[model samples]
Target: GSRQGKDERTTSPSSNFLLSHLQSIIGSPSFPYSSNSPNSLSPLLFLLHSFLRICSIPTGRPIRMGNACGRGKRPAASRDTSARDNEPRVAVNENESDRERDEKPAVTPSPKASMKRSSTPPTGAMVTSRTRASTARRPSTNRSPNASRARDREKEREREKAKEREREKEEEEDDPIQKFITYALNKGVSGLRAEFEELRLKTIPTKEQCSVFHMVANAQKNRYKDVPCSDDSRVILKELSMGTDYIHGNFCGTPKNPKRFICTQGPLPTTIVDFWSMVWQEGSEFIVMLCNFNEMGKVKCAQYFPPTQKETFVAGNAVITCESVAKQKWPGEVTIRRFTLDRIDVNQKRTITHLHWESWPDRGVPPIDATIQKLLQMVCRSSKPAVVHCSAGIGRTGTTVSIQIVTELMDSGKSMETGLGPFLIKMRKQRAGSVQNDQQYVFIHRLLLERYMSEEEKENAKFVKFAKDYDSFMV
Candidate 1:
């Protein structure tokens, strides 16, 4: 019983504490407390009555029981009169009351107010109702008609544009040209070969078909004119940084990787300076010379680099020196000549790996050559773009570049069928007349097919002896 009594005393609000708290609320000048105020004191008196009832004390009498009220016990007076006399009250003037009420901000109910409000009975007052209503009716700014309409229109436009895009995408999915391209790209080497054979026997690029303006205008001698290097994004001499004024070579690379090749024509004797300048400017590490110095008794390409005996040649501001020449082992299918090109003006030197595929006749395919594949591998491994060129830099050059791209794509896990056609199209866009004839196109397809073959499939006993003879022809 003693422990229970001590617990009650510890948990209950001390009389002094309650008295001081009530004094603060009633004493504040800004508080809307008034003795004459009917509803205000009703709530206050009701709360005190509830507390006294909880203490198991009589509630009808005003009693001073805490040390905080200046005396320890209730004064000997009647309950109602003492309650009114001792309670702190502030006087109010009608004018002062109006000003204070207007200026005094409404008090927001604390989180504890809800629990406490229900714990006590209603005091016949509207204090709690007004607080809840003020919170519920929090002010918000109004929007103008134009602003609201603009927002609605913006949302409507977004929805409409989204629907329009969906329709366009559906139309594209149904497009015949897009379907054909998609079909062609997804083909394996075998399918590509069959397609090429069909095209070779059936199709040709007529003059009327070649309508692009720059393509028609930049042709050389009108004979090799269709294979003009793209002038718009043509490779510039980095040393000079002069745009499109130097060489007839355009920067052609895969869409995923753009700095892959400088597709250009075989350097003419007169254009040798520009060619070397391009190599140095592009930081080209490999010079893929696809044609010979002469083909079918005609000088198809200039002897751009000096031979073994004559080790040096000067071209424009650069001096070309043969560093080392290694001919592909007997039946030399490809001759690899390493040259150190010295920029005389800048006193800088860079070594260029020159790959020469000699026996590929003009507009004709050589006997299945492994040397080209070897060259492609070397180019793929190199960090810089290979400067690739043939007699016109379109036929043989196109085939070789296409092979390199297809092989690279295949090695990267892309299906061979989808990459070659798009690669050839992109190549021709950069340098016109690429893969010029049906034969060259077929050669590209055949090259990719050979990669897909088994060793047994490649080993033909019928041509076993011809292979030996072919080596002699290559040498």
Candidate 2:
């Protein structure tokens, strides 16, 4: 056929010329065509091979003299042969071919070659298995077995330490007494004093006129003109028809026990009957008197109870008889008196314990001695509510009551970081002026700090220094 003859003429001359030219270029020493080198002429050889394959295609049309590599379609017979013979036919050394395959850039695949590749199964699974086997054979990065064990032991120790710290935190949270002790010790004496002053000044409300105490009918009932009685917690007399049921007293205690003590002023001569009435009405078995009947020639309180044993005094429907009197001066100056209280109208009788702390001055704190502690113990032993009183019922009386409250809270494991201040505020809410002065406030902290110290610590010279520092700060 004419087309076949024309194809032979087109392919014979151009293909032989390109092949000879490629061989000449490769033989040149300056061309850098090495078997191991990354730079190679494999791509140019493949292009020339494709051009020869296209020229050899025997189409019926005359072989065009235009560009053979551009837009020209290969006949069906040539397509299969060209796809199989995509690589150059010029033979090279086997080792050089392997090197070229590894280093040479990938050549773009013809359409038929791409279709053949897509139909074959992939080899990724085999490669992944080989990679896993190689990784398993690799050695660990640790220097030695001993060093590895040492690192593990250090990590275990760190974990145990963290666990121990967590346990201690839980214990501190569970035991409020220890927590409070830690807090106090952390804040030393001066720090505690400053905190007390700050709490008193910032949080505690000042004394203001209470409308109920200011009423004309109840105004004369108060012993001190300045101290006001809270109407909400005041004890009301049952026999109100006799006169007024007003009494200068309040039901004051901690949050846990609100009516632990009946805080009242020292009995006036006129209000002695009212005071006795309050005692009977409240069913109080103990009375704590922190003031004397006379101090510095001033009448701080009236002789409400009988002065001598076997002596009796009648006030309203109650008869109060002094049964016995005992005085002690070892721990501190205190007088203990027993009284038998009889209600004539009801035909009932009860014994009352009277603890008179005479050494404590009016509007002042008592000595930090065992006397106050002993007095508190006596009050605690009695199963009934105790009546505590000073001249105005706001200084020494409030201090004693607050001390008992704080001590009870610490023993019972109740929270006490901010409880003391709020508890004092609650007391003042009941009694207008519960804690009288800043000195009394500091005295409360002092007593608490003393209780926190051990007996050995107390005898130490460090404690003596602390006492001096406390006294100077108070001054």
Candidate 3:
């Protein structure tokens, strides 16, 4: 009996120590290592008492740690409770068992992305904040590649358009040099009649040159007397184009702000008055007689710069008037022909060569332009020299000059591959510091190319139809 008692004492004290340690962890009164309350016993003392009671129960009597209340249940938490009476239930062991059961087999857990997050109070705030911030600013995930590319292309197009406008501005400043180069290329060049590489066309004018007529001179000699302009109307040059376009200002610092249009108002717009006056001053030999010849005249421009001055036509830029009769030693004869577009009569009457600007055609304009083109072909067929003219004899004049150059390219058997660009460049050079607006230059080329291609289309259509018929017969 003494041995059993001794063993009981030793076991009881050890169990009390463990229970007291657990209750201390929860700050329960039953195991309070620290206590400021008067109603509570030290945790070690209560735990020791409970161990003694449990020991007694092994002898067959049951041990109850607390006094039996009206109902055998723990009291609710309150400030009045003594530490010993408020002992925690022994459910810690059951909670541990449940956690172990629910947990997955311990995996070598993936190293947490933010290695610093695993801690006692795992706030994980830095990592979470970083994740949230990145998610908040993520690029929109909704756009398709096509939409993105289209936006990029649109931006690129705008950039290109800006660059083109800048380049055109620079070009206006560089006009003189461009014009000089064009002149160098086109000087001593007549419409395709002379071989450039084979012969020096600069040699004195010949019978072949004689074969062609100078229609510009003819128009000058036969120009009607007068068509007075209204005193209120004025003219100005809005811009100078190199080949097809211009910057927004004039070469002379006068801002001739040109509006884009089809130029169907008259033979030429009044914006180029200064330019025309300058041309007139340069050549008195080319007399432009604006007159009222619209009714009987076959040419549209004839109404303004009529052909009454046909007798004044000469070989050069001088009137060669008998000033005091001493300067009349070298005499030049003038020949005049009526300008008309009657197919049979005009063709026969047109002995010399000519390309008439007044005879050319375009939409909303008289067929004079067409007649000009026809006269040009006839001149080429018969191989005659001709000249083209208009009222101011500059814009339409320049256009006719350009057309003749294209025909010359054709007649010389030279491919247009080497001609059109150089041709316009030359025409601009021929006219002092003149520029074709982008539309005008493009229109001229389009018209010529369209006509040229129409012939090709006719030929191609015939061949295609024949091939289809042959296939059908074979089937």
Candidate 4:
């Protein structure tokens, strides 16, 4: 009964003075005991809070030094200085296999002699102190300035590790499309054998499809940017940071200049991705095409230049987030699903906007217009414009946007020829460093014709084929 009572006393909010202090600092929104908090705060923690506010410092961020509220089942507050000094050396369970490990932060007890208050040790009487000391409050058992910071550093390390994992995954996502496009360029799009001719026939190693599954492997610690695209094969996996704000291309393509790189989250220009392409896809005999899309299904390149730029009214654009749900079975298998990102802002210069396609899915997976309509409806009450892109945003991204554009114009009673000519000219100027190949030119043109024309017509037409599912080749 005494042990149980002690346990209750140890775990309860009343005992941990630091928890009370943290509550005053972070505030009562999360706690039941939250009082008229500001009125209750001792002038000290309030001063610290004010200092943080003045610095424009993020208070809750792991990098910052802030009081950490202890959570979970609390151990009975230790008495006896020798016992405290000789804290058990519990073996870490690697995973949270033990209750104690799960409940407490890792702290190896120091081998140095016990720290006892020279005059009066933390006695049971002090623990049950009925009177508050008038002279001064002695240090508590839990007092440690570096512990919270150490925990913060550990948490920060975990955050960085998770971010690094995500980037490696995204690069992995960019891999297959990179390989397939490279296969088309080097081996020619005729067969699967050509996709991985290096491997034995019928032995389709998943490694050949690394581009398909970026999250293929659970990364080992300290491994950042694992299994990246070879330099020459030209894979440009453009990554973005979070947020939905209007970004204009006043000055494009400045890496070191810093001022040149301004947009957030959507794909960067083709110039940037293309510049890195040679480095990302280096070793292969032939050049590979790049696949650069966002967590959302829409391509970033398409978002940049648009007849397809999405329109919004009550909503600004789609805010995006993603998680890798599919679990891979073998050593190297990835399970990731991408989603479209929210648009930054509306172009006041244009009366209307809709998603356009510079290139369409080679598999004819789904109509770009239909997909755009569905995504736009999700973003705003009505459909807004959008564009699709792969790394060399000019090619695939431009083409997908162009295809969607053609259909939109046709809906407006504009002829295919009229839309096609003008759109291509603009694409050339928009992405001009490299040669926009004839095959890519034809690919977009075919997709434009593919959109208005029936599926039966596509079936009847010979020489090319489309896939049955989203598992089609274009992915």
Please give each candidate's TM-score.
0.50, 0.60, 0.24, 0.23
Give every collision pair in model 1. 185-418, 187-417, 219-225, 220-225
Strongest candidate by lDDT: 2
Regions of candidate 1 where Cα sits further than 4 Å from its true position = 1-223, 238-246, 330-332, 415-419, 455-475
lDDT for position 462 in model 4: 32
Model 2: pairs clashing at backbone N, Cα or C within 3 Å? none
Encode model 4's per-residue lDDT on 1-475: one tens digit a residue: 1322111111122323444466554554765433334343444554653343334322121111222212222334434433332233333332243455557654543322112324232333342232334213666545676777888899999999999999998764554333223323333233432222322223222444333223333121001232222111222333321221111111112112212111111234423332222112221111112243442475433233211123222222323222112333222222222322333453222122222322334323233334433332322332211222344334343343444444444454443322244444433332331113434443443344434445564453231342222124444
Question: How big is the positional error of residue 356 in model 2, measured in Å on the Cα after superposition?
Answer: 0.6
Ranking by TM-score: 2, 1, 3, 4
User: In order, how many clashes per candidate?
Assistant: 4, 0, 45, 50
The 10-residue segment of model 2 with minimum total lDDT is 1-10
1-475, model 2: which lDDT tens digit per residue?
A: 2222112122455555665576556545666853223665555555765566566533322222211322223222322233423333322222343446446444444444543454432443233454556556666667678889999999999999999999999977877665555555555566766765766565443334366567778766777776778767777777562377777888886645668888899988778888998888888999999998889999889988987899998988889899999997737878888999999999999999888878877766777766777788878776567999999888889888888887887777787765366667766777767778766776776677677777775676645666777688665
Quote model 3's TM-score. Answer: 0.24
lDDT of each: 0.60, 0.70, 0.32, 0.32
Candidate 1 C-alpha lDDT tens digits along 1-475: 2111111111134554665476565545566653333435645554574464356432233333221222223223223344354333232222343446446444444445653555432444345675666655654335667778999999999999999999999866764433433443345334555665554344334444344324433333222554544545466565442223456676777634677888887777667777887787778899888777877788888777887734898888888888777778423378888888899899998888888878778887765657677777787677788889888877888787777766656556554334355566556666666677655665565444455544674475422333343344334
lDDT by residue (424-446, candidate 3, tens digit) is: 54333233212223223333443
